[model samples]
Each structure stands twice: as structure tokens, then as C-alpha cells.
Target: MPELKTPDSLETQSCQVILSVLYQLNLNHENNVAMSSERRQFILDCLQPSLRQRLISMITYSLNQDLNVTCKLLDYLFDSGIPHLDLITRRFSSFYFPADQVPTVYRLLSRGDPTSLEKLCIGIHLDHSEEGDWEDEEKETICWYSGVKRKEESVSKVLVYNSYFYPTLEKMKKLRHVVLHGVCDNQALSIIGQSCNLLQYLDITGSSDVTDVGIQNLVFPPAIQKAGRVNLVNTRARTNPSMKHICTVLARDTGVDVTGCIILLQFCPRQWI
Candidate 1:
């Protein structure tokens, strides 16, 4: 085995090893002694700052590979107090891990500083078609950050999965955009409306739980109202009798585009209007 060099040299050597391990793992070959050696070296290289940054960038870009490897590398980078951990978070705009792998990824993310984790746009996609016995997978994924405390006062954006919206909303105060799917009742929307004052765009499509009463309470403050777009597609508000009131408020509220107003009246009868 090669003796570890000086601290600086060790960092560089660790980076090289990590890079080599990643390259080899991506190859379509069987695992062997050589592969194992490369893997060990890669782990070592991750200890160096420069090498760690490079490795993090690679893993962030190549998340489709072994999720375990990428997550392990992330844990190492985070634990080492790497300065670029924020950068790594920014690079990870989406997560496409399998249902089984979500818990591991969530656990690792949960352990990191909330500010570090919030720097990235975390997205979890749930396919009802995907076969698995995972219990309440959506709740598990969303609740990962339940107890996390935000060091910073704000975050860029937060896009949540179907059922994960309620818990994650209060923590994200500086969000610029939010995309909500599935059913969210009046209370959920109200919670979001109150907490996220800086939100610019909101997409709540296919949400059957949002009613006109809920929509009525979602008032965009004057500042955000100046540059905000709300997309409410296939929602219960489409046919609700109270939609007229909702539309009237939106029309009176300057800065909101009324061109998409048809969505509100789509399911409502002509007589209702």
C-alpha cells in the first residue's frame, strides 16, 4: 500500500483516486481487485479540498450512476467541512433515486446543515406505477428536513412532491418559485401564502383539494404581485361558484395576468358566471 503523503499531497492524491474510481465504476466491466483498489483510492482522494470539489462536481453531474457512491461521496464532502458543499447542493437540481434509495439520500441530507441542503433544488418524483412496498414514501421523503434548522434567512426555490408540501413550506422563507402537485386544501395554501412572501411563481395543477375559499385567501403581497404568475390547472376551483369572486379579486389585483383566467371558469356552468 502507498504511504499517505503530506496533508496537501494526500488531498491531491485522494482526488485523483476518486476520479479514477468514478471513471472505472462507470465502465461496463466486472468488479475485481483493480476496481476495488481504484475505489479505495477514490475514497482517499475525496479527503482533499481541491480533489473533493472536482469529485463533487462529477458526482452531481452523474447522479444516475450508483446513488450509494454519490451519496457516500456527498457525506464525506459534507463531513470534511468542504467549502464547496454549497456548490454541490446548487449543482443538484433534481433527484431521481429509486424509492428504496430515497431514505438513504434523505438521511444523508438530513444530517447536513439546512443551509447547505437548502442551497440545492430538491425534487422527488413519485410514480404510482413504480412497484414497491415502501410505506408512505412521499411523507418519508418530505419529512427528512422536519427538524432541520436554517442557518441562513432564505433559500432560492423549493419544488416539492405531491404530499410533501406542508412540512417543507414553513422552513423556506426566501423561495422565488414553488411547484405544488396533487391535493392541497385551504389550510396548506394558506400556510404557504403566509410563510413564503417572496414567491414569484406558483404551479398547483391537478390539485383537487384546493377550493375557491382556499384560492381566495392566497393574496400575493404588492411586491410579489408586481412580478408573479400563478398556474392553477385542473383544480376544484375551476367549477366552483366562488370562482367569480376569485377572478374579481385577481382582476383587481394589479400585476397578475388575467389572460389565463379561463382556467377558473372551465368547469363552471355559463349560468353560474
Candidate 2:
């Protein structure tokens, strides 16, 4: 049977309904998440592509807006069916998506559809708190969040230090365009060069940590680019919003470039593939 295109208002309503249900179910099982996962997947499966995209966009906005949504909620969405991102996320500020073994979590969720994603744009926060409340040595974990929320909302910031991003980046074999802002450290950049070998365009505008060393990895691909090997492990971690975060989310507020203020990026027949 052919699917009917959902109307604008109806699609918006559908997204609201799905979000409300997921939020409720998400709260019901804090400990045994699998139960909600099953239900969430059912919800994900029921929606048409249009409705699904709306829901994902709303969640992404809420996440970047410093709303009440928590890290656990993101996990439920992921554990359920790993919602297809309308955009690959250039404003992942708060780190509310689950932190430990994030690469692994990505691996598992994508098991159902590995090539579902292509482009990836990310911004990892690297600044410290202004108050200087705690000694650098004493502060083992910097908050991934914007720090505007209650202290309890924050999570450890070891993701960059451990540098487990490459595995996750590698998982999406068909990945092409890549964008890194703020957080892409040298190590992360180096691995991205190694893992996402088939990339067509890479933009690392604000990724202060990446220097010539990292850029070289992509520039000279033969030594690092694996011809066809596309496989990896998993990990997960989670955050929510602020100023540096604010600008990015706004730039990507809508799926369509309504204002014609931004340049669209696309990739074609892999010249290197």
C-alpha cells in the first residue's frame, strides 16, 4: 500500500503525541530500560518517515535548548530504535547523549541500519567553569553540560581524554561529509582521518584542538584509509545546553535553510572510493 504524505499540522501533532508517549514510558522504567525500549521501538515503527523526522527534530531542539529533557531520555530514544537524525548534529554541546562507551552504543543501535547515516557534524565543549570553584587537580570530571543547570545534571568529561570516537565514526561506512567544531582534538581528528576514509568534504572550523597533525591524516589518506574495512565496537554517554551551544543550535534550527543564510553541503560519487 502506498503511504499518504502527512499534512503539516497533522505531522506536528503526530510528533507531539509520540514525544509525550515516549516521555511517559521513559519515566515508567528507569531501572529496566529494555521494557521502554521495546515500546519505543514500536512507536518508532508506527510513524511515517515524515512524522519520524519531525519528532527527531523536536528532540534535537529540546536537547540544544536546555529544556527538561535528561540524558536517560536520549538513551530510551536510542535504545528503542535509534531514531534517524534529520541532521547529523553540529551542536552536540551538553553531551547529554550518554558518555561511557558511546561508540559502542552507536554500534548497537545502528546494527538495525548501519548505513542509515552519512554526514556527521559535532561540537564538543572544552571550556572550564568560570567560578573556579574547584581545583584543577581535585576536579576529575568537568561537566559536559552548559553548567547552567543544577550540578546533578552534569556528567564526567572523560570522553575526549580517552578518545573513543574513531570506532563510532568508522561504523558508518558510507559516511561522506564530516564537520567538527570546538571538540575535535588531535587524536580524534587523526582517527577520524583513519576511520572515515571515504569522506568527500571535511570542515573543522572551530575545532581548536586539531592542528596540522590531524589535518595531515586526511590530506594524506593512503597510509590511514582502509579500502573496504568498515566495522567497529560500541560506547555511550550523555548532556544539555548554553552560549557557545546556543549559536550552533540556532544556525541549524530548521531542516530547511529557510533564510537562505547558509550554504548547503552535499557529496557525490566518491572519487577516492
Candidate 3:
């Protein structure tokens, strides 16, 4: 019988571990039986820092095509100690399907990667053309939602609907632009006010859950004394005429750009032109 030899080099073993990780991630994403947690850990422990960096780049490059799988793999890697938010953000250049952005944002945020949150964009957008809608039967009105647009390649815009992501916001230090819709409430706003000092633009359209308390937090936070743009369109603030004056006062006092002028007219019955 011919002698059988095992590959003993760290390079060879690292390659095997990477392959196993890829397979396990894909299997988990597909709802198949994935490699056991113990097995996964064993393989991950074999990777060196250099190999991890290389894997991150490779994962980022492959993300667009296999986002679900790659994201899971990224999560595993992040948890296993290759935890650099830059790796996640560097892959943002790839086009992601609008529907997948929400889950992706959750995954990234839960990882507590601050560098990735600096300029993040997460939301669900639907291409409303009749042809596109008809072709993609799964994309019904229930799935179509408001999301953020990339304003500048440099500045990050993170848009989420009904985001209860306040817990994760504390980890973000360099956030600049944020647009949230749906169920974002006073508490979430307060969290942002307390944590995101560098916030420049804030749009909370459809945030009916927010009230004067949140507005107070946004206006009075010591960290955000500087001026910034605020859009409260279609928010609970519309029901309270008094809050309008508060926003106006904040804007005047701090040179903040406070929109939602139309909503203000609901109570005063005057043209805001």
C-alpha cells in the first residue's frame, strides 16, 4: 500500500478551516443541518490573524452574490474574535437587495461594530414599476417599504423602518446621518440623542411612536448642542401643535434645519410658506 500523508502546514489547514466555515454558513443560511457548534469553534481556532484578514476580504468580495451566507460567516468570524467593523463596512460598495438590508443591519448592529455604523444604510426599498412588481410575486405591498438613499459616497446613511435598534446605538460613536421610519419611538430617539453626538441629519418620518419627550431629548442633549437638520414629517409631533413651536425654537436657537412645517399647520390653521 502507498503511504498516505496529511497536510501539516498552517496554510493548508487554514484553507480547510475556511472552506468548512463557508460550507457551514451556507448550510445554516439555507436552513440545513450545519456543522456542530463545537466543530465550528475548533475550525475557527485554527485561523491566525493574517488569515482572518484575508478571509474578511474574500468574504466581502463574495457578499453581493451570497449575502445571506456571507453575513452568517461574518457574524461567526466577528464573534470568534476577528471583530473589525471596517471589514463589514468595506463590503458596502456591493449592491444589496432592498429586502435583505433590515436583517443585515440587525446582524451588523448586534455585533457592536462601531466603525461600521459610522455611515451605515439599512432599509427596505421596492422598485414600484408594475413590470418589476408583477415579475417578483413575493414583493407585495406588505414587503415594500421606505429606506435610505446613498447621499454621498463618503457619508453613511442608515435608514430603517420600525427600528427598535436603540440598544445597539450606544456602541456607535461616529454616526452622522440617520433616517428612520415606522415604529421608532421616544426611547429610541433618546438613545440616539444620548449616544450619537456626531449626528448631522435626522429624519424620523412615520415615527408615530415618538412624542414631545423624544423631541426634548433631541433638542436638549448636551452632546448635540450644535445645529443639525431634523425632519419630523408624518410623525406624532403633528398632533401636538405645541411641539411645533418647540422645534421652531430649537431651530432658531441652534440654527437647526427643522422641517415638517406642513404638519405644524394642522393646529394653527395658517400657511407655513
On lDDT, the candidate that comes out on top is: 3
What Cα-based lDDT does every candidate model obtain?
0.42, 0.41, 0.45
Pairs with backbone N, CA or C atoms under 3 Å apart (clashes), candidate 3: 119-156
lDDT of 1 at 188: 55
Which candidate would rank higher by TM-score, 1 or 3? 3
Count of clashes, each model? 5, 22, 1
Q: What digit string (tens of lDDT, one per residue) describes model 2 on residues 1-273? A: 999986668766766776777777666765665686676577556655555545666776554532234334443344222334422352543343323333443444343343445555444343435324554334332222221222222333433433544455555554455555444544554555455545555555434333334433333344323443211111111111011011112112111122112111111112211
User: What is the descending lDDT order?
Assistant: 3, 1, 2
Candidate 2 has a TM-score of 0.52
Residue 188, candidate 2: C-alpha displacement in angstroms: 3.3
Better of 1 and 2 by TM-score: 2
**Root-mean-square deviation of Cα positions for candidate 2 versus the true structure, in angstroms:** 13.7
Put the candidates in TM-score order, highest first.
2, 3, 1
Per TM-score, the best of the predicted structures is 2
Candidate 1 lDDT, tens digit per residue, 35-119?
Answer: 5456545555645555565666656664455666666556545433333322223343544444444455545544433332222
Q: Give the Å error, residue 37, model 3.
A: 3.1
Backbone clash pairs for candidate 1 read: 14-44, 14-45, 15-45, 17-42, 18-42
